[model samples]
Structure formats: C-alpha cells, structure tokens
Target: MIVFNEDGCIKCGACQGTCPTSTITVTPTYIQHCDMCGQDPKCAEVCPEGALKVEMFTVDENALDQPRLTFNSSLCTSCGKCEEVCPQETCVVVGKPNMEVEGFCVMCKKCVEICPVQVIGIPGIVEPKDCAIDLEGKGATYIVNCVGCGTCVEPCPVDAITLDKVGGTISIDENVCIKCGVCSQTCPWNAVFISEKYPVKREKDIIDFAFDSTSCIGCNTCVEACPGNFIKTIGSNLTIEVPDICAACGLCVKVCPTDSLDLVVKWGEAHPADAEGLGYDAEKCEFIGACANKCPTEAIRVVTKTGMACPSLVQTDEDPSFVNCIRCGACAAVCPEGALTVGSIEKMIDGKLVMRDRIEFNPSKCTKCGDCETACPYNMIHLTDDEKLPVKGFCTLCGQCIEACPEHALYDK
Candidate 1:
C-alpha cells in the first residue's frame, strides 16, 4: 500500500498525471489522497520520498509514529488556520481543504482540535478530479500578447497551428489539431495553450507577407532581413520563393522602397524570440528613415500617426561605446523631427540616377555581356557583383555588392 508522509512532501505536483482509474488527485499543495490502486500505489512509487511501504493495511499504529496529516472531508470548510499556525514556511500545510505538509508534521495535534467545523483530520492525508487528455490542441489561448515572431509556427510538426496579432483572437482547429503540444512549448510569451478546454476564438497570430515581382527591383534587402534565410531564387527566374519561417516581422516589408512588399498583419486564427540587442524609445524617434538605412535587419520601422504603413519609421545606448555614434550629426541632417543636431559633417554624396530600366552606369566599365545579370536579382543589370547576394541597382548603397565586386565593374554611378 502507498502511504503519504506529509512531512517529507515538497508539493512538486509531479504525481498528479496519467492515472487510469482517476484514483489519485492533487491540489497546489499536496497529493490529496491515495486510491491505493488495489494495494498497488503509483503515488508511493512516484513519490520523491521513500515514504510508502508495503503495509497490508493503513491501520498499523506505526502509521501514526511517522507523523501524518489527516482531514475529515465531511467537516472541513477550508478556512486556513492550520497553514498559519505551522512554524515551517507555508509550502507545507498551505492548502486549507487542500493542505500542504512540509518535512514532518510535528504531530502537535494543534490542528486536531482547532478546526471550527472540526473538518481537518488532525494530521490529514489530503484533495481529488478530472483526469483528461486533450486530443485536440484545445489548450491554446488567443493571447493579448502575440508578437508574430513565428517561433511557435516553425516548430509545429503537424502544421495544425495558426495565429494573429496582439490583442487579436486565435484558435486551434480542434478538428485538425494533432495535439502534439508544440505550440504551447515553443511560445515565448506562454500565450499559446494546449488545454483540455479550447479557449474561445479570438484574433489569431495570422500575419502574412508577399513579394511583388513587378516592382521587386531585385534588391535582396528582404533576403538580408530574413533571419531564417528563407528567401531564395535559383536563376533569373521571376518567381521568388518564401519559406515557412515567414512571421511577418516587417523586417523586409519596411525596407522595400518601390512599395514592392506588403505585410498583412491580422487575418484569421493560426498557430504560432528574444529579440537581442534591440531597443526602441518612441518619444525620441524622429522618423529619419536613416536607421532603416543602417539597420541590418530592418527590424525597427517608423509607423506613421495616420496609420498608413510607412516603411520609414526609424537604437540606443549609454555611451557604453559599442555603437558608432560619432555625434557627426549625419542623423541630424536626415531627422524629420529635427530632434538631433550636428555641427560640421561634410560630404555631398553623388547620388545615382535612374536611367531606363535600371540605374545609370558607365558604359566603359560595363561590357553588357550579362556577367552581372545573375547578380541583379531583377535581371536589370547584365553584369554585376559575385560576392554580394545580388542587389537592385544598389539603391540603399548598403555597399554589400559593391564591396564584393571583384572587377570593380558594377558601380552605383
């Protein structure tokens, strides 16, 4: 028989699962009682304490010597006086009708007579319950805090999950959910659930993005912005491939200058990081569009007050001296808020102009042999860089393709 010693119990709640007959139950404090399993006790075997022994019956007088807690289920009103009287901290003897007992119940019997209704058995064994397994991933909740990071969506093996934005509703299709528990496990916010009870359908974390081929310009900024490296093109094919890691972070959508990228933030319900080295203080933001220029991932963006999606919104620091804040005022020149000021930084950038299909280029340096054709993702340039991921006329002057150009043949001029 499995005997529960209240003193040795840590109240970890590890014992309350997967029992066949529902013989055992648990409260937050301790195992309520043992069903004995016809003399075979699972809780005793599972207990961290070797507290249970093979006694033919629980009536042996020695059972009282080890110190135990008992509760008369008929009389207990669950008013917490036993929990307050214990010298040990509250983890033991903590629950009222569901009491917790720490190491050993000193056996003082103070609890025996203290019950106003006389419900708590002097040293009571403890609570009961619905033993259920959720066949559907019904435990998921449409949280008020979905970030659309795509972390949860990527790990789901069955692809049964869907999600929307923060403050949006979400639902796991109970009919389709395989109940693998992947969404609840991967959620950083603890927002997704795989409960026995399905949370109501609210806005889901359904964010989607699309690539526009007509105005694509083959810039590959989206490629660079993608953390998963999910964007790729085999040859000069006009068709672009976006992979499953698409979480609609707006990293790529904000950087597309020709309005070639669109991010649909919320649509329907769906299944779904720690963003490192990232901080945004909105009051100081001036919508410069320079940070978007400087951002490696374009994670930070300026959203206009009119609610129109502006790819331009525009990081931080103590002079921990990690960032290149020369105080050059280059940002000041570009700040629409005029929040920043500069003294004397010089260099009139010779900007490139659009010619016909692409940027104006020096014909003497270009053979027009299509060597750079693959380098231009949009096929606008017949000859281009080899090291870079192929650019769209070097619009942002990110210097990736130009720096990697081996022959100095591709120039922004």
Candidate 2:
C-alpha cells in the first residue's frame, strides 16, 4: 500500500488518532502491525505515504496456514515509517540499510503512535511461526514480543507458521504462500511487506456510429424526429449521414419507413449515400431533427449529446379526438415515415425524453392483442382495429382502449 521514509516521521501520532479501529501504536522507533486482530486491519487509511499495504496468503487444501501479501506500487509513496517503528532494528529502511539494533520490542506500541505515516498494521494469526521457513536465507527474523502464547499461530489453516522455539526463526516459504493476506491482517506488529508491479499503457481508436441506406425511404421522419438534432437529411433521397459525434442510437433505422436503414456494426465502412455524394448536414437542421425525437426504436440518442431539456417533436395541441383514441396503432401503422409510435413511459425514458406516466406502443410490433378491450368496463375499446384508429373513431372519453392494448400502445398527449 504505502510506506514512510525511515527517520521521516515527526512522531505526531496524527495517523494513530485518526485511525477508526485504534490499530496504530506509538513507540520509540515507529508503528508496527498488531497480531491480535484476526482479519480486520485498519492501519492503511491514514498513512500519508500509503506504505501500509495488504497481502494475501494461500494454503494447500490439505494445509491452511500458508499466507502471502500483495502490494500495489501505484499507491506507495516510498515512506519508511516501517523501518523506524520496526521492533527489529535490522529491518531495511526506505533508502538506508543501517543494521543497528533499536531495542527489544515488548509490543509496547510506542513506535505506532510516533509514525507520521500511517503505514503499519498487525499481521493476522493463522499459521504458527515455527512452521514458516525463510526461503531466501536473508536472515529472516521474528520479534521476541511474539509470546509462546501462540495467539497468532493457529488461525492459519495451512500451517504456514509454527511456534516451536527449536524450529529456528519464523520464515515464509514463497512456494507455500498463496498471497491471501490473512497472516498480514492478524499479526500484532506491522512487520510483513509486499511489492507490486506496474502495468503499461496503450492507445485506442475513437468510436462512431454507422447506418445502411438500402432499407431507407428518403423520408425525413428521422431528421424531423431526432431529439439531438444531430442527424440531418442531405439529398432528395433523404440520405442520412452521421457525424463523428453520432452516438449510434439507431433511431434513424427505426424511423426509416422502408426499413432501408440498418446499424453498421463495423467501422470505416463507406457512408450510406457515398455513391450519391450526399451526407447529413448538421448545420441545416431546422427542428431538433428526426431519428432522436419520435423514434419508436430508441435506436437514436438525443439525450447523450444535448441532454434532457431538448424539445420533443410531438406537438402539445390537444387532439380533438384525444378522447376517442382507442390506443390502436392504426395511425402509426399507416405512417409512411415510421414516425407515429405509440407513446409509453418506458419508451420516453429509453428515448431520453422527459419522463411521463403515459405508455405507448410501436405499430410494427403490435399484434392488437385486445386484452385491454375485454378488461374495459366502458365501451371505449373498439373491437375492430381499422375502425378504432385514432383518425377514424368515436372515442367516449373513457380510457378503455388505452387499457385494452396489452402492448401499452396508447397515449393521452
């Protein structure tokens, strides 16, 4: 995690006081890990250098005492509070290698309080120290503060550490360590250390949207309906072109009457109107252009570019037949531009339109399942699809038709 430089600590104990778990201790040299807590290590939060880090320990399925620590170098500040507070004087300092013995560690916790950096924590108790072996033969040592009390030994299921005095200094076998960090969490003194490697950065290309023209009808429905006003019509054929800023919302394809528009999955493909020399004109857009405004497909995105306040193409004029609409999709079904989609609360959210309680439907998908007709207590839902169309019906202000369409293909506005 993080560490402070040796002799860099001001011995203010600010970190220890700020610690929520009371895990830090002040001593003659610096702060260290306490081995009593089993899994909770709270010392890493206040460390100025972020030297205090966590490690993992892995034990064999048959043996559970093995544990190891994993370090994150990106977080380390190269502070040596670890060395100053270390009970063992031989511990390596951030930049120095002084081998002077500091003093016998009685688990006094004096060093923990003096550390300016909050990089220390108690190692967890799992394996007995006797079971540990120094693989590097680097003069691996343990503090006498480690009582034969065996409080820190058995928690390790892998038997990585042992407590027998005759078994030599406590050691960590690299092969046995699973990098589980359990031992580091249980230790009373902040003694164990771990290191991490940094990752390399790479470059990436930008992303954009594409559309197909064979299915397009040259109808400006998409251009007039787009909420973002990003999509524009350039040719009499109504060839639509998306700029680099196009978010690929697919609304253009949804509004195309002939289903001539399809989303382009690959990049760098020729534009839909490349042969016609026609491209969408972002500047010529008069009203918040189509694809985004009235798209039933929700393939176009207006909210991403212009945000929620963008005006919708739907007019507020109260339809004289508003009371007669049976929620039938006949009007949308006859639409040549695919602009008349049934309004719905869900569709509004998907289109990034202002949220409303109304529900709507797409004529393309509506099977006219008249569940709403049977449930209508009022004689409002027209049984005949063509007769119930919004343009040709005697709707009784009763909202039976609105509730009749299971597809939720009805709107009051």
Candidate 3:
C-alpha cells in the first residue's frame, strides 16, 4: 500500500496511473485509502515526487522505534480529503462516517497517509497474510486500477516508489522472490502478473556501415556526428571506413549538408533513400554529374556513351559550398533533351547504368521560366542556354549536375 502527503500533492494524479490495484482514491482536498487491498502496496513504487515514504518495523524493544509515516510540514498544503475517506476513525477527522466500521485497526497502517503534516494516519496490518496461489499460469499478480494520482509512495515495502523524477517503468527481481505476492495484489494498473509457464528471454538489434572507396567524400561530418565513434573519413573525397563499434544511429545522414552520407541496413534497406521526396528538373541539365561524385553511398554514378570526356561548359576556381545549395532542381528542370535526371541520391542509386528512361528533359516543356535557377542557393545555375555561362563560381566541387546544358552531353573536363 502507498501513502500520500495531501499537502504535498500537486494533484497531478500520476500515482493512480501506475498503481496495479484500484486501492487509491483522490478527494478534492486529499486522497482516500483502502486498507484491505493495501496489505502489500505497489503504489509507493511509482511516485516521481518523493512525497511518499515506506514504514518498516524494528525488532529491538526499548528502542523507541516506531514505523510511522512522516510528512514534511514545510511542504504540506492543508488538503483535508485524506481525513474524509480514511477507513479507521483515528485516520480521518471528517464530520461523520457515511459507512459502518467493521473492526478496529490493528496498527497495520493500511490507512496511514505518509504525507505526515497534513493527512491523517490509521494503523492496520503490519505482517502480510499468506494466501494460496490459486492461479496456475504466470499471469499478472497485481491488477491495479490507476487514477494517475501519484500518492502511494509512502508505504512501499521495498522503497521502490521514487516520485522525485519521471515515473520509471516497473522492474521485478526474480532472485528476491519470496513470492509474497504483495506487489501483485497492491498494483493498481494490473500491469504485474506472475507466470510459471515459460522462461524469460531478452534480445537487442545492432547495425553497422562501411563506405566504399568512391562512396565517401572525406567530409568528416559522419565521423563527428556519429555518437558511437563508428565512422572515420580518410581523404578529401569524404572517403570513410566504419569501425566494428558502429550502432548506426543515422546521425551521419542528418549532419551531411551535402546529402552524401547514407545508411545501409542488413536487409538491403538504405537510409536517406527512404526519406521524403523533393522536386527536381531534368531538362537543360549539363551532365557535369557533380551529385554522383558527392554521394557518400556510391548510389549515384555517371555513365557516358562515348569514351571521350565531355567538355566542361563552365569552370571556376571559386569553391561553391553545399551549405548554400538549396536543392532546387533548377539545372535539371530547364534541360532541352531527355538527358538530365535529378532526385534524392537513393532514388538515383536505384536506377540502371544507362538511366536513359529515368533521364527527362523536354525543350518544348520550357516556358522560359527562371524559377529553377533563382532557387539555386549556390548561384551555380545560369538563366541562359549559353555554354560560357557567367557564375559566382563558389562551387565546393560537390557536383550537383548543371541543369542549363542543351547538348545532353556536357561533363567535367
């Protein structure tokens, strides 16, 4: 059974939610208690406020030791409901008893509100009564109907109810089982049950990643963001190698501003690939194929029909940082031929080497709209079809394919 400090209660009702039994009741001012159901209290184990306490008896005589609930007067708020519903006459100071009393309390403390200063304390049973285990199967021993009021921490036998913090989940120590069944009987949620049917089991899942030679960009972003110290970049291309310690939290995917890093699960599932779709343009795209080079998973690759290198339509020494690339598929959207393809790296990886079917560019579709280039954060896209397009040239070399190409054959020289 759990006890409460009426004055200390904020009336949040968190204890009622955790109790395995429906033994706890809250009044406008204070909480009421039931003694018979509280022989072994589970309510005290779930309070997060530390407003409750557990009472234990000492064997030594002449010790002046009495197991009583103590409430801090400094904390009490003068809630009187604790006295209104107490089972014992001494437990409550309400006007009159609405129900008849069966017997005198044996100082069992079943009605004690450990919230010392404000609420009353009625003594009842101290030792738990031994009862036969009628249920053969392992089922919930405690079925508490929780009111979500967290007042039961006071009388817990094991000092289990810790209400000072968030309510933690319940745990049972099988090794300490005297099978007293106190916890099961006192729980309000009916969340606790005992079973002799099957053995207990536990399991956990782990994942790891490894970047191929051409996959990583050596950005070190994955290494810095990985919580498990699993990834390390080797060179400027962001080339990476994942160690055995990787837990695969996918933080690398979130931190990669270039959208280069990716996570591959054991079942062939890829991270960032499953992310939401973004818009892109296919026409007017210069096949410079920067997106493929920047991809960390090697999921994107450029395929050329001829062995000759495609001439660079534009070049600049200024490094364009991906930090400014707003991912507006402008370069791909204005292409004339069906040569440019733009999408998430994962979708690009799923395509065939030729990608002819996936590539889309229609000059007829062009409305001379400059919306695509205006959306470029790096200012890499030019509004005109001219090959020697003037640019701000802040390219980080994190190639996002140019969308202004009309030849359908432009490449990095």
After best superposition, candidate 3 residue 352: deviation in angstroms? 9.9
Q: What lDDT, from 0 to 1, does candidate 2 have?
A: 0.35
Error of 3 at 399 (Å): 14
Per-prediction TM-score, please?
Answer: 0.20, 0.16, 0.17
Ranking by lDDT: 1, 2, 3
After TM-score superposition, the amount by which residue 47's alpha carbon in candidate 3 deviates from its true location, in angstroms, is 45
| TM-score attained by model 1 | 0.20
Error of 3 at 184 (Å): 45
Cα deviation of 179, candidate 3, in Å = 60
Q: Report the C-alpha lDDT of model 3 over 1-413, residue by residue, as the tens digit.
A: 33454533322233332232334544334555444335432222322332223465542353433442323333333344333444432233222333211111233432332221223333232322222233332222222222222223322344444333223344444333222233333332223333211111111123434444555456686666553344656665547765532233345665665666556533221111112232233343344445434432222333322322222323444332221223223334333331222433322433432211121233444554554345332343434453333222112223344333334432321
Worst 10 residues of 1 by lDDT: 320-329
User: Please, what is the whole-model Cα lDDT of each candidate in the order they appear?
Assistant: 0.35, 0.35, 0.34
**lDDT preference between candidates 1 and 3, better one:** 1
Clashes found in each candidate (C-alpha, N, C closer than 3 A): 44, 106, 82
Clashes of 1: 44
Where does candidate 1 stray beyond 4 Å? 1-277, 296-413
